[model samples]
Target: MTEIVGRLAPSPTGALHVGHARSFLLAWWHARSRGGRVVLRIEDLDRERVKPGATDLVLRDLEWLGLDWDGPMLRQSEDEEPLRAAVAELLERGSVYPCFCTRREIALSAPHVTDGEVRYPGTCRGRFASAADGERELGRAPGLRLAVEPGELALEDGFVGPFTSDVEREVGDFQVQRRDGALAYQLAVVVHDARQGVTEVLRGRDLLSSSARQWLLQEHLGLPHPTWYHVPVVVDEGGARLAKRRGDATLVELRERRVDPRALVAWVARSSGVNAPDRIGARDALEGFRLDAVPKEDVVFGARERAALG
Candidate 1:
């Protein structure tokens, strides 16, 4: 049997919050408990949102929680060769086409879905013969979008169980590369997962929709799919998901208040349906870790939870 490989990928767009803590701790527990190797990857490719010194804070918080990973940490921006190669391969295989539609144009063409995604209507599909043709005709650079086929793609998530999605109907042809020459998240994540030999993926359920599109890319690129686990996400009292931009119960705030990291770990463990002491190390909570025991509903993070952490 192949050794299980997992990843702790965090975007340095903002400070780590309690919501992030829960997800990271669960991910750490899930991998470490099974004696698996966990690779750390900094997803800072979104230069527009990447915060200065945010990466250091993320590292600091992870260390504070005693979430250790194997091997050297990777930055998505550190290497562009693999990303470029993946895009090139897709282009060569005719799996993708140039998209010249701007954001505003796409938005005006359709209403935003519940997940805040606008199901792309294949606006630029076959609109141009090539990237050069798109630029020549539109007088601007063109992004690359996968020519998604219309059909349902099913998957069995390690945690969420059976799931299905039709990328074409849900999101249509999605972009692999942006017009600004940046590799989109879907493409970047697939390339990184393949290159790092990640055998399992455990993250927030909010990204569950992405698995279908990623599966398509994997098949197109001949890359293997990893075991998927889309666990529940932490939301505020109002049921709104926490965002780094909102400064919602940040770990930094807790640290400044002298809140014990172990306390936070205990809270996370309990929230995930595990019984833990008032203060417990992340590793200590892994003794009888079971994925099935984790709650399927979104975990609430509000005043009561914060008070408990202190």
Candidate 2:
């Protein structure tokens, strides 16, 4: 944590919403409060879902909100070559293997599970003797998985106090790369964070499980571990998390309705327990910034929030 590097990684698959802005603002505040720096990383690896001008819109929105980054923005797509190398290294280390189980097959195995989780039962953990064996057995390309050792990973979270997880049982050898050869988010994120010298990760609590998975990868890859703060997620009236894919209220739509950026930030500040003025910018909002001050529970967007944006 020497340099105190942080990042706002947004996948340019759709227009970003207020929830996205809240998380990004928190990240920017965390870094700037320490007189450190923030980096903007465009995670556009999911090609099919990536909109043509989504990246530009996201940058414009961030600028409009008055958040600044230290250097050039990084895009995940540009790191394809490095991702391939990392995959090769994992394969050679014997910690990675091909998992030929289809989504349907895996879903059936973990039938009792809910909440959109399809845990890997280690069905194909040892099915393929080697890469050669996997290649020969594959009628279709197989997804790659990392074998996990039985142990618990404990990491101190800044926002949420002491966190520990048994990644081995909770999550078996998870996918490192998809069957289509696209690198998994878990592996790609860990590699990029390490390469960029990131010392902290500030994102939503929905990805809390990811920390344990990424920690194992970091340990195996001999990379430095960054402190994590999984801030509470933004949920809708129904208590379901807001998602870009769900066509949630985006910044573009709100802007069109004449909603000011300051209004949005002020709402976020109050919602996250940051005492602030009626209107404020990112820098000004820092006056009340405190990691511990942020609420531990999720923020619900109801009728009041809808009227504020609309």
Candidate 3:
């Protein structure tokens, strides 16, 4: 039997909001049910946006929720060297190249495409040959990008059923390392997941688009792709997605309002249509939790739901 491993990777930019709490709970419950290990990883590679003491806040929030992780928690900033090595291997195999095109250049070059993101135009694909000197300068400026071939990338999502996306058409060639000499999210997540022996991925549906890029990198790096489960995202009253930046529905706010942790868990379960809001105790909630019971429709949080738990 294959080992079932899962992780809860939260960026230390702000307090973990209710949406984050739901996602973390799903990851923890899934791993606990399978008797697998749950790893807590801090995705703080975006140094420019990371907040001071945010990591501590995340740890505190998880502890407040009564979630325990095995082993020492991992940080993306500490694993840059390994990701650099993985990028080097891909470059050696002619699977990646240096991209010098700016975001403005790509947008101006392709006006018909309206995905909002600038899909790389492959400006540096054949511009430079892989040189030994170039490999030594991996950490320097002018980031590297994976050359995505034209094809349909498909995967079976545990909750969402079968999903497919065309990489070259949707995302184009994506970055492994940013032009500012930072490791890209796609690159770091792929390498980290493989290194940690993660057999399953439980994240929110907001990241569904990114799974295609991750699958592409996993195939290029010769790493095994894990099964995916994109849980429904919690939204605000206006139907907008809840974010840590918004400061609305954050765990910190809930705690200030005198909300209990178990009640919060029950609230999340009830809001997502997984359990009753009146439910008490962790074991009762966990036993009542069902991945299939999660509603496919987006759940909007309001004062009434918050009152239901309190």
* RMSD score of candidate 3 (Å): 2.9
Where does the lowest 10-residue lDDT sum fall in candidate 2?
Answer: 110-119
Candidate 3: segments with Cα more than 4 A from true spot: 112-115, 129-141, 272-284
Cα lDDT of model 2 by residue, 1-310, tens digit:
2789999899989999878988999999888888888887889888988999999999988987889998888899988777788889888888798888888888888764523666688888777677567778777778899998888877788788799987777867888899888888888898888877799999998888778889899888888889999999888999988889877978888778888888888888888778887677788888788888887889987678878653
lDDT of 3: 0.81
- Per-residue lDDT of model 1, residues 1-310, tens digit only: 8989999999999999987888888888888888889999999999999999999999999999889999999899996799999999998999999888888898999785637898888888877667787788779988889999898987899998898898888888999998888889999999998888899999999899999999999999999999999999999999999998899999899999999999988888887878888998888999957778998899888999888776
TM, every model: 0.97, 0.94, 0.91
Winner by TM-score between candidate 3 and candidate 1: 1
Better candidate number, 1 or 2, judged by TM-score: 1
Clashes of each: 0, 0, 0
* Whole-model lDDT per candidate: 0.89, 0.85, 0.81
Position 304, candidate 2: lDDT: 82
Best by lDDT: 1
* Residue 10, candidate 2: alpha-carbon lDDT: 90
Rank the candidate models, highest TM-score first.
Answer: 1, 2, 3
The CA lDDT at 309 in model 1 is: 70
